[model samples]
Target: MATPGVFLISAFVFAFAAANIGGALSYTRPPPRQTLSVPLADDLDSNSPQQVHVSLVGEDKMRISWITEDRAPAIVEYGTSPGVYGSSAMGNTSSYKFITYKSGKIHDVVIGPLNPNTVYYYRCSLDSSRAFSFKTPPAQLPIKFAITADLGQSGWTNSTLQHIAASNYDVLLLPGDLSYADLLQPQWDSFGRLLEPLASQRPWMVTQGNHEIEKIPVIHPHAFTSYNARWHMPFEESVSDSNLYYSFDVASVHVVMLGSYTDFDPQSAQYAWLQADLGKVNRSRTPWLVVLIHAPWYNSNTAHQGEAESDNMRKLHGRVDL
Candidate 1:
């Protein structure tokens, strides 16, 4: 009973819709890419420094961190020229145990009052003949920062590291999920050695992710055991007692690294610290404020949707002026 023109238009629309539905039903997801694990360096001597990396401390200080099989002095000798040591700073050493795995001696030394935008040559300890060097970030604006997240130990990580190394960035800001050790302590060492080439040359400021929570209930009874022992941030300077959350200033920017896996309720310490930290920020001096968190506050992806961390953080951000 329909008119010929109307019938023809309806048929066309039906066919088009059917074709699109069929295509959608037949769509196949591509296979995931294969990623290889980065092996640990076996060439270095037992006492030789390995996994050497640097991180920013206060305004004019750098924290040199490294691991050695045998106990070594937590000392760093640095100067402008190679092999010409002028000043030295000593720090502390500590290690951790994870189930059956025990970590090597980890040394952390805070060397400082360094000149900005200048390269400084340094060595870990007096016993080592090998030397390494790093360039301090620029003191003022136009400072370049490389932001990375969820960097696991894999072939993809290597490729990413190579790209970051070529970027010549002044500082590196890692949101979280470093190493992806996931309770495997040795993977942390492998990750350190893997990133040392780039991390040593520049400052890598990082925070904790879900993967860093290596707590195993009563068996382990502790969270971030390995992380706390290794990647020590300048939380004390920010008046934060825990290393999980902290803030630092570089150039004209102030960066706040928040811990998404930790407690962030209204009555939590992290929440209180965040409120105080933001209150103390002087926007006049620091024109730019950058905040980093592992769990995204806004994500369209179906995965990790409606997670408590993301939900609470999003709500919290709405309350804050930032």
Candidate 2:
């Protein structure tokens, strides 16, 4: 069941819990990275497509995003059946140049008017890539979601993904700290490959966390350049001008993904958006309202002790129970 609350511990806590549950078996070796098999021609070597994933843009709509080593045309052929692409959508492509490196080209395509609860087949090509399939969210109530936070490309990640796959989640919500790339650009590539199994098949909605603040002193001092370029959330539909905070709907639930690392003060833009968003939520349509943030305003964790903004939020919204 999905509960409305704060996540004090990060993704690593889940990994450690799994280890404890397995007893001595927990000492077993971590699983190897999963890979998809494709023909040599489809691989396209350096220019091959990678890190392909999907995000829910709105009702009957989805966003497919991917990364490529070189600039190329981005197109997605998708339909309800394998090898029978009946529809196609063309979207924008961009690349980020930071410090001494220029990141790979990123592509995002939004496809829409899809039938709810149906499986869709897709093949993305920047150069050449394999086909993948995904099932849309159900039209009615009872949507299952899998959520994890602060994910880095570590050995424990393999096991965590196995558990998520077994759960049969309709969507995945990562609140923050994806890849933990810090400043190592290659780590982002590796992390994307690691998450393909779950992310490629379902919408992976995320919010920025502190770890994503890859600020290079005296060089590339801007924040969220990589995160913004890759994960294109549908903030525009919700009237939010920032990717750091946005909301989406699935089934009867309205999910609000917030950025704890960004400004959340009473006078900040995010706070204003938060108030307006919550005020407009039609409980008659979406009965459940769930909030996700990387850092809790009231967490007992010593590392974040004496946090202040959560108090402001509590005062702003008043005491209420889910």
Best by TM-score, which number? 1
Which lDDT tens digits does candidate 2 get at residues 1-322?
3344322333323111221222232122335554322222443566677788999998789999888787766888889977888899999999887677788889899997888888999888733347788999897677888988866776667677889999988889898989877887767777777777678898899988888899877788899888898888989988897999999888878889888878889999999999999999977787778888887665355653323333333443443452
What TM-score would you give candidate 1 relative to the actual structure?
Answer: 0.84
RMSD of each: 13.2, 8.6
Cα error, residue 237 of model 1, in Å, equals 0.6
- Identify the runs in model 2 with alpha carbons over 4 angstroms from their true place: 1-44, 126-129, 303-322
Estimate, for each residue in 1-322, the C-alpha lDDT of model 1 and write its tens digit. 1111100000001111221222223323334445445555556788888888899998899999999888888899989998899999999999888989999999999998988899999999665566899999888878888887878876678778888988989999888888888987878987888788888889999998888999998889899999999999999999997999999988877888988888999999999999999899877677677888887664454553334344344445666697
> What TM-score does model 2 achieve against the real structure?
0.81
User: All candidates' TM-scores?
Assistant: 0.84, 0.81
lDDT of each: 0.81, 0.77
Worst 10 residues of 1 by lDDT: 6-15
Instruction: Give per-candidate clash totals.
Output: 0, 0
